[model samples]
Target: DQQVKQNSPSLSVQEGRISILNCDYTNSMFDYFLWYKKYPAEGPTFLISISSIKDKNEDGRFTVFLNKSAKHLSLHIVPSQPGDSAVYFCAANLQGGSEKLVFGKGTKLTVNP
Candidate 1:
């Protein structure tokens, strides 16, 4: 079973608009949440992350929000640009010791300029 899930397979947004990617998890033990962006042939690169203790974290135009009670998290990109288009994967893991990470199917985001 997948501990993490991204309900939407893809999302499209106009340039300068906002793109939101959603994720949900069935495991309550997850203490860390991470979002990664992958290009066509390159590896997934770390984008933004949020700790279970915090409700939100932001890096430049990217922001990650975690809702523990709902076991859900989301990544928000404001002023979404063409360069921001990629496959976004949401991942979760135990912060302290577990090297294991659970990842979602990934959401393909298309930014139209």
Candidate 2:
């Protein structure tokens, strides 16, 4: 099965603090991973991505780490802000030719000021 999973359904954090979200996968064929941030009534926007070949990738306040051996991944948001309060979906794709993506149910991140 091409099932990608996010075990935690939600997370909450105080503003200016760190927020972490976790995900897992059962399929080893997955080659590319992505994190998408979505707001109410809006489509998810591409946040960051890491190739299966890399263990870590970072962007400004966001960082993603992939552990291929464990079939796990995580996203860390530093100094979380109120604007960051939304649903985060961890997704994966086969990469190369097809565009089919598997997404988790999503984690609702609440940032309190």
Q: Considering every candidate listed, which one attains the maximal lDDT?
A: 1
TM-score, one value per model: 0.96, 0.94
Reference-based lDDT, residue 11, model 1: 99
Which candidate gets the maximum TM-score versus the true structure?
1
For 19-113, candidate 1 gives per-residue lDDT tens digits of 99999999999999899999999999999888899999999999898999999999999989999999999999975754788899999999999
Each model's lDDT comes to 0.94, 0.93
User: Candidate 2: misplaced stretches above 4 Å?
Assistant: none
What's the CA RMSD for each of the models? 1.0, 1.3
Across 22-100, the per-residue lDDT of candidate 2 in tens digits comes to 9999989999999999999999999999999999999999999999999999999998999999999999888565358
Q: Candidate 2: give its CA RMSD in angstroms.
A: 1.3
Predicted candidate 1: what Cα RMSD to the true structure?
Answer: 1.0
State the TM-score for model 1. 0.96
